[model samples]
Target: MTPPDSQLPLGRRGLLAALGAAGLSASARPAPAAQRRLPLTAQTTEGPYYLDLALDRRDITEGLEGVPLDVRFTVCDTAGRPLPKLRVDLWHCDMQGRYSGFGEQGDDRAQSFEGKTFLRGSQRTDRAGIVSFGTVYPGWYAGRTTHIHFKVINGARAVLTSQFFLPDALSEFLYTQMPLYQRARMRDTLNSVDGIALKAGGTVLGAVREERQRYVATLALVVDPAAVPVIDRPPRPGGLPPGGPFPGSTPLSGARPPRPRALEGSARIRAMVPPRAEG
Candidate 1:
């Protein structure tokens, strides 16, 4: 049987080793800033698809088909210190843009996935403040770019709720070339035009690279461990609101305002490109 997270080592050397085992390097460490506290990761609405299934496993695919993706997250405090023992929950839609356990997804109102679970799982951070999940590259839906939703929980309180985006070029390449991702029509949104992606700025982009048969995406999440969870009104039964999952111009709202002409040329959008491998 696998050991518990508390049994793991947490020193700097041990942390680096653990990170390396998870396909990350010491370079994944957060750089020192002039200020003592780093900016907390931007928060966003959790959308209408989250369900606390209490599943504790690394592979959430459950035999689903698509390009393999290994998702890794390292949780840290505002001071860049690793924070261990926190529970990280992750979920995303499958290759057809359908979420498990939801009868209504996108425009498919008759679809039924009730009692099913896939691409959804939870893991506790090891001493290295890292948790990893084995899932597939997510599919896109109307009004949103390709993204994955995650939450950081301290005990019973959810300290952070946000979504991270995949690089548009990688996503485009897969959707057009991979037979599993082919759809009747191409995705309607890109990272540059996604409202939530624009609101999240550059920090939401995960560092991605190919490893053998699968791809790995890594994200460093700096958070305020003591932050109080913000409660938003529940979505209307059966689906999200008409405009989108979120409905406002605010940081946490999911409003789909007019596309900005300069977003594609902005530094934030440019950061969504996948980084080249270091020699």
Candidate 2:
């Protein structure tokens, strides 16, 4: 019962002609760089928690100490591939940004938000699929900058939600002390180039840092129906019933396609297309 990330069966007029076939004019402009690799949603969406809390907070799975963060992001595919089982649902804004509620609260239904259900717990995609969360670093609320609001489910029609910032130790400490967060700089933003909607973009944020600080990174998600199928079909430990012959099963001879490891770079995030426009 999970298949909505981008909900692409190619319906709804094929996602509005892939979000309008694009041309580039939101502002920044230089995308056309998805030469080969695929699978990136370039996600983002937690603006100071978007302030919708009336009451709903279990201390958010106990995360609000002060940068105690253990951030880990991994949902790549735009050449920098890495998407295992995919099911990362996160919620943010507590260091002081606010956001600590969802709806119909009763048992707090895990800090309801009606979506991304995770006051602090919804990470999968391991075994190299990548998806780790032990968050903390989230505080600048008012105007906006240091962010975190995810929803990358590869099985439940949320496609590639968004929100993920922190690139350059607040941009070299705000270019020195504080200069409007240096316009959320990351090598001159624009999602890399006037990102209205993948006019021809692909670089699903490789990683975002506070100083290559390693606060945590692995966010390289780009999605829009072009290609999102990293199927290794993992999850076969102890026993086997898919066709008999367990134990690393495979004797009928035909089924060998799971090899792509050894990635240790960290640093790259370019997912900005959400000011509020999703037809």
lDDT (Cα, tens digit) per residue for candidate 1, span 150-197 = 999999989999988776666666776667778877666776567777
Flag regions of model 2 displaced more than 4 Å: 1-34, 37-39, 42-91, 94-98, 102-146, 152-156, 161-163, 171-221, 224-279
lDDT, candidate 1, at 221: 90
Q: Highest TM-score among the candidates is held by which one?
A: 1
Deviation in Å, model 1, residue 227 alpha carbon: 0.8
Q: What is the C-alpha lDDT of each candidate?
A: 0.72, 0.40
Per-residue lDDT of 56 in model 1: 96
- lDDT for 79 (candidate 2): 59
lDDT by residue for model 2 (74-150), tens: 55555554557666667665443334543322212223444533345566677666656665555443223444666
User: Model 2 misses residue 118 by how many Å?
Assistant: 17
Point out where model 1 deviates above 4 Å: 1-28, 33-36, 233-279
**Candidate 2, overall lDDT?**
0.40
